[model samples]
Target: MFLFRWPVCCFLLAFHKSAYVWAGYDVSEVTCSQGLSECTVADEMPLGISESDGADVQMVTAKVEVCCKDNAPCTLCLLVDAELSIHVGEDVDKSHSGHDTENDREEATISTASVTLCYKTPPTFPACKRVDFTVCPTELKQKVAKVSLVITNPAGVSFSSIVYIYPSKALHLIEVVAPSLNEVCSQNLQKSIKDCYMPTVNSVINQEMNQVELKFAARHKVCIQYEADGRCQSWESKTIPLHSVTPCLCLQVWDDDKPRRSQSCPFKNMGFLQKNVWQNLTASVRHGRMNNKGQMLLWNLSAPCRLEGEVWPCRWTSGHHCTEIEGFRQQLENTTWEQNSNVQWVKMGVFEDINLQLSPCVMVNLRGGGLHLGPFCSHHIIAAARWRWNLLAVAVLLVIALAALMSCLRHDFVKKWASHSFRGGCAEIGRKGHVVLLSPPDIHDGFSEVCGLGSLLKSQGFSVSVDQWSRMEQCNLGPLPWLHSQLLHVKNLGGRAVLILTRKALGLAHEWSRQQPEALQAGRGDGNVPQSPYSDVFMASLCLLLVDKRQGRTGERFLLVTFDQDVVQPPGSLPEPFQGLHLFQLPSQMKTLLCELAGGGNRKVDGGKSKAGWKWGILDGWKLKTKHTTCSQGAIPTQCK
Candidate 1:
């Protein structure tokens, strides 16, 4: 009875501890073949077992199911303890030491075991059947125990009944504000705020309140708050009336008090319309009375007219009528005319003379009326009349004075001065008789040649004189002076003058003719002579020659001569009234005539005609021997010898 009772008591104690362990666990009633629990365990149990030395033992297995989130690893812990002790006999221990050692081993035996179970795939199980168990009979007598198993399912396990939890929800809020006025809206805000749900708070607040009269309130509570708090020191508020917007034009206008002559307008705060109206009105007023100004009345219209210091009333007159009536004389005068009120007219001319007393009107009447004339009127009329008569008188007086002066100063002046001063000096030696030479001073070579030729003529009993007019340094000498002096000199010398010229002098002569149209047209006593004869002495006989020093067919020096039949005419075949005079090249046939003149002469040669004695000899030699000589005429004729 004692032995049976002891085992019973031990079993009862073990069962009691196991009941406490199961009390802490939570289990599900709907357990599938693989399902989860809040807590679980695995155990090994042994029953009806004894040791060889009379020791009793039992084995038991217990497991606790630990639940975790699906797809996460789980661990289970099992509690194990010994339920009974083994007994060993003393005699058995002396004869055979096994009983005593068995009892000791039973006392030192462990009651716990641990196992690691890893689940690598999903939907892992915590069922009792899935639990792995192993028991050893020798180990069972030591103790019966519950062991812990760590089950890891890293790949996860899913359960239909498990509660799912989510992470917390939190966010940041951003508010964008815009300006009160659209014009002042921030560019960034205009881009960001797409929805109009957010209200725009105005920064400014009005302090004035709407007034209301109370009628029936017995008890009332009123809250009055200053929009700006105590910051407003003195409260005063009013509504301003809105003004109408107006369009404007930019313009400046002059004021009444400003000086009329000032260039800048003096209007202070004039609007566009007022300024423009004022400008138009002022312009009209000025235009109407402009001509009444004293200065305007005195203005010279013939010259450039001016308005407000700027050129105005621009017009030009060529005096074509005056020109037509006076012919070439018109250019020497200018005339302008203006009409005063009541048909009274005024005329003016520049640089003119007036002889009012000689007019057809009574001298008293003319003197009383003052000259009624335009700016250039008196100048024009007086210049025209005075120029005509004064020019004639001056010319006549100059001519008379020049004649008397020349007579007084003549006294063989050329013979005493320039006759022997030149190379080949002599009175004359040429076949032509009494030749006088004249030329401008610049052509010294031509002058020398003329002197030499004159000397040569003097040697042959011909009188020759080379005279020059005194050089006038200033160009102010009037036409009358030049003409009178030159003409007087020519008449004194019995009206015979020869002008020798080079190419350069010929060009100058042509230019002079062009510049003086009146002189070119001035008629001479002989219609054949140019109107304004520059040289007092015309070229009665002209010669031009080119001497060749190179050898000819006979190895002797030769001479080439050219003469011009049209020397009186300009280069082109234009009609008389020639524009100018110029020496042009003569035809080849003229060369033969020139050669004849130079080489042939028996008597004296004059005006292309030969005399009997010396001219006849010279003409015959020129025609017969020197015609085809091809040698210097000065050289002795080889054929003749």
Candidate 2:
């Protein structure tokens, strides 16, 4: 039986070796022959066995032929099942008669049943070309998941270490422990994972189970309403957070026992930020009020804010109706008065109608209800006690002062009267008599009038001469020789000379009298008289006043006129000798004065009435008068009359 069992066992062994049961390829010994060609060898021999145990073993070899079109590189692989067990200590001779053999072998015990062997010339494309990909469901939680990919070339190669499957989480954990490991492992894992994972284990655990819940508080609105019972009731409501799953929730409440005023509320004290919160609350209340019209009571309670015109009365009686409370009319009028009071009162016209009834008064009623009269009303009444009395006294004094001032002005305007008499008979002056008007130089208007008077006197048949004595350049009387000579000549010719002196000329005469006393006193009737050159001129003319008119009073009489043309009256008394001079103002009525001097006669002395009449009369009268005076009463008139 031992002999028969041995042959049977040998036969079974031979069958097992020929049947092709899978023994995993030796990965360490595998290699590519050319480029991509594949080959397999089966040998009926044991590859590795303990020599001492004498166990039989068999070996298989896969030859990978690698080739590329036109020398392009390629890849080759050999596959085997891991379920075939290989003894730990195994060796086999792979030498063949005509084939070169490079042998390296290893046996491994693996948990999974199948494994593959690979042989590759460095691939023409990169080995397991680095692939970048994106995955879905951006958010994720706990679990191991699969990711799929389609590769370009997946022929005879079976994946082992070349292609690996890993949980990104496990790889991450491993990376924490072994830092030197390629960071690509963790990076790939993160790329493959759908969810973000917390780095700390504790944080991840906490986040996975419990989430935080947040709650917000209420915003409150408060309103006060007047009740019929004369009590103010306050209604307060608060808005709850809408996100909370509760509706119609009362978050805050307040009750009022007495009437409350809006002004009395604490809201007024709350500054800007708090007031904004109140505004927000009121806005919500207003929204609620709008939505629930039927629930007016509730709406009022919700309406913490008041509308601009929404004040309500507490009671409803006949006299205390809402209308009786004043429909903004009284408020408007009061506001107008308050704003306008500061404006200044304007008097519209010279006599504005003022109301005494509306005027402010000082009198007051006594505590016993009796009215006080007159100015004794108040100690502070300044107008009645002091100002009125002072004003009346001032008015009376003003009247008396005004009357006295009028009397003084009247006295100034009244004309004063003067009396005088002539000692000599009146002279009948002929046209041959001459008049000389004198004036100062600086008073041009006065000098002009003197010139005009000379012309006027000449027209009236008098030989008139004007002496502008004030025009003399020298300050001394010696320069006035021509004036003295002319005066003497006119005097010798028996002609009259009128000296018209102005205020300035009168002043010069006083100065001349002081400087030239002899010339001033030459013609004085009495030595005691104050002398003036003007007096000398007058005396010379008086000596020549012995002419006679053919008609009227006839005598050796002369008119000596010393007229002052200045507006001021002469100062002090005139000398007795000068007093006899007929002084008059320069006649303002020139035509009337001329007519009076012409004796109202249209006819000339030597001819009938015509333009020639006045000229002829003046020439004839001069001749006749000169002859009549000089004839000594008996000779024929030698000069033509």
Give the number of the best model, judged by TM-score.
2
- The global Cα lDDT (0 to 1) of model 2 is 0.27
Looking at candidate 2, the ten consecutive residues that score lowest on lDDT are 342-351
Which 10 residues in a row give candidate 1 its minimum summed lDDT?
278-287
For the record, the alpha-carbon RMSD of candidate 1 to the native fold, in angstroms, is 46.7
Q: Which digits, one per residue and each the tens of the lDDT, describe model 1 over residues 254-286?
A: 223321111111122323223121111100001
For all candidates in order, the CA lDDT equals 0.26, 0.27
Q: Model 1, 398: alpha-carbon shift in Å?
A: 32
Q: What is the lDDT of residue 72 in candidate 2?
A: 32
- Residue-level lDDT of model 2, residues 1-641, one tens digit each, is 44443344344323333223323223222111111011122211122211211111122223222211233322222322111122222223233233433222211111111112222222322122111111111111121111112222333232122322212111211111111112322444333322212121010111121211222223322322211111222332121111111111112122233221122222233232222121111100111122433311111111122111122111122221212122211111111111111111111101112112222111112221232211111122222333554475458446645764586478652221011012111122233444445443323334334444554465444545454422211112222453565556556654644545444444434444344345432433233221222234444332232112222322223322223434324333332222233344434223323332443322121111122112222223221122122211111111212
